[model samples]
Target: MTQVNRPQPPVRIQSSRVAESIAADLRQRILRGTYPEGPLPKQDDLILEYGVSGPSLREALRILEAEGLITVRRGKVGGAYIHPPNWSSAAYALGLAMQGQSVRVHDLAMAIRELEPRCAESCAEREDRLETVVPALEKNIEASEDALGDGAHFTEVSRTFHDVFVDLAANQTLRLVVRSLVAVWTIQEQAWADAMEGEGRYPDIEQQKAVLKAHRAITRLVARGDRNKVGKIATEHLAATQPRVLQFCGDRTIDASSATAMRGFRGLK
Candidate 1:
């Protein structure tokens, strides 16, 4: 006697799975500049293009929105807006993860102390330092000098110096990683500056001058292409300056729900 095979049932894909597949395709398109002009094509258009139901397409948009890839607005003028991910998004995610793990502010400071100097060293190693790196840093130093007496303003300018330093580094991966850490640290430091100013304990002008001196020294080292000295100087400068903020933070963990960080995210392009 011979046995016969039964007919097989059609495989039905879940809406959620369909949504994920739709999301992946749209996500790549958004990231690759497919919709560079504006918010994604109208939802109706996307639904048509993907040949999926409205619910499935909407679910796909939801996934991208949650990942910071796009923003969906609801109104007569509403549509899903594309927001390509950048360093700030990376920083916000990093901040959330650190907050989830209860990572301390001092721990973040320590990580920056070790990592950022390498960025400075890399800046010194850049072949186009004169055209690309030095001018930006020197201009930032001038802003720092002008901001010397205003503690809060000075802190902001000084932080920009480090931001520019990291941005100028030749290593793209290190630049992004360090810059994310710096962005997170900037929120804390700026908050500390505000609090200290309120309490009349913000670093005095003399202390601000000292910071300027260190920044100038580091700039000179980079201009001279002295990678060895620039890294060492950067390390020393961070060591001296971080304590002013860290002392206020104590054992407090970074706040992922920080309104400042969120506000920064909102302004990202």
Candidate 2:
């Protein structure tokens, strides 16, 4: 038999392991709301707390900062501050990967099609749907009406309605993923708006009215806790609304302008 050798993955250095361990410990404390002790502790204090070298402690803090869990400041007065997790960051990161993949406007539509309607189902399934979900969605509808014919205002409000619709689903993980999807789609919406450039900005009045009507009906279904009905209605509504925006996409690839808008989505989300 001929001798053969198998390649193995590179070993993890001990220093990297120590830094990761410290980062994990700090992340757990932050999530559990047990750290910071009023003001973010000094580096010296953290070094003692983790019993790690200064370099290892600094590396761990850098890791947390990259994960969007903490913000580090540089000054006599500056200390690390805990930042709540942001889906915008996740969405913005996903957008970069999407740009590389030549993702299409239809891809965005499919994502929203699967996600936002399930959110409606979640609202319907919730025990407190009447007291919580119904009122918020009603508010969204009312505001949408107020913004009618005002392209910019209506666009923002409608986005909020979609965001809250998913948010009301009561699953944090689902809310995070869907919220990021919503953020990504907003890039496509802006691309269409820019394509409109000097042409008619807002959709036809009847089209806008139809949107508001569908939202109202979905909210009603949610109030009644009709899960199947809410899900079906929402899926149909988003599917119907998508083609109107697909008209503006360029070659199934995010154009330079739209890609720029996508990169800036963190601020919007």
Candidate 3:
């Protein structure tokens, strides 16, 4: 795969919107061990803390839930409880929202170009830390190699490899954005993988190898603190892989700008 180079400043102009702020505060608290895996702070406590109403507090909790931070229970035992959030549900919501969106391979390429440099830059900053992310990347690479003959296994490992970037980026907002996009891409890619499975080419070991190689190279770049090189490699690697993905899937039918349609359909956003 030909590596393409794109560079971005480390800073991103993230929104300080109300919900985002509430979400950020709560995420910080959770990360700092304020919540842990116990019952969440009572709604009244949260309402008092934030000077918000029951509805607003509930909305904040919803964001937490969407991010996989808390489990809201009903019945006598039910209230919000702190737990690690999984990205899968959010990813699926993104997948459903993108289900009918009009997307071309090039549109996918364009979106990636916009987002990846930021991820690369962030990952590069944390690359040397190696406390959480780099090991996870390597682990997924190893897992992929072992799972090459299994279609279901390969799909999962591939997703994990990409997800490592989201974690490394370390920006909650960007993590959410890329995760949602990955969910949609996964759906499209899965379709292709399924088709390939039918032709006795179910396991594309070579494709996995290419993707793994790209990841390993990027990891090395990040470890070296070469932000420019990392960003370039990320863009090039992502863009070059489009044809490989498209070979297994078709263009998306719905554009993300019409995401409101998903809300109407689900009665939730």
Question: Highest lDDT: which candidate?
Answer: 1
Off by over 4 Å in 3: 1-90, 100-106, 202-204, 252-269
lDDT of 1 by residue, 50-88 (tens): 888999999999999899798899999899988787888
What's each prediction's TM-score? Answer: 0.92, 0.80, 0.59
How well does candidate 2 match the true structure in TM-score terms? 0.80
Can you write out model 3's per-residue Cα lDDT over 48-102, one digit (the tens) per residue?
A: 9887556656767788887667878888877898875456556555555544554
Of 1 and 2, the candidate ranking higher by lDDT: 1
Regarding TM-score, does 2 or 3 come out ahead?
2
Q: CA lDDT of 184 in candidate 2?
A: 78
Worst 10 residues of 1 by lDDT: 260-269
After the best TM-score superposition of candidate 1, give how far the Cα of residue 175 lies from its true spot, in angstroms.
Answer: 0.7
Model 1 accuracy (lDDT, Cα): 0.87
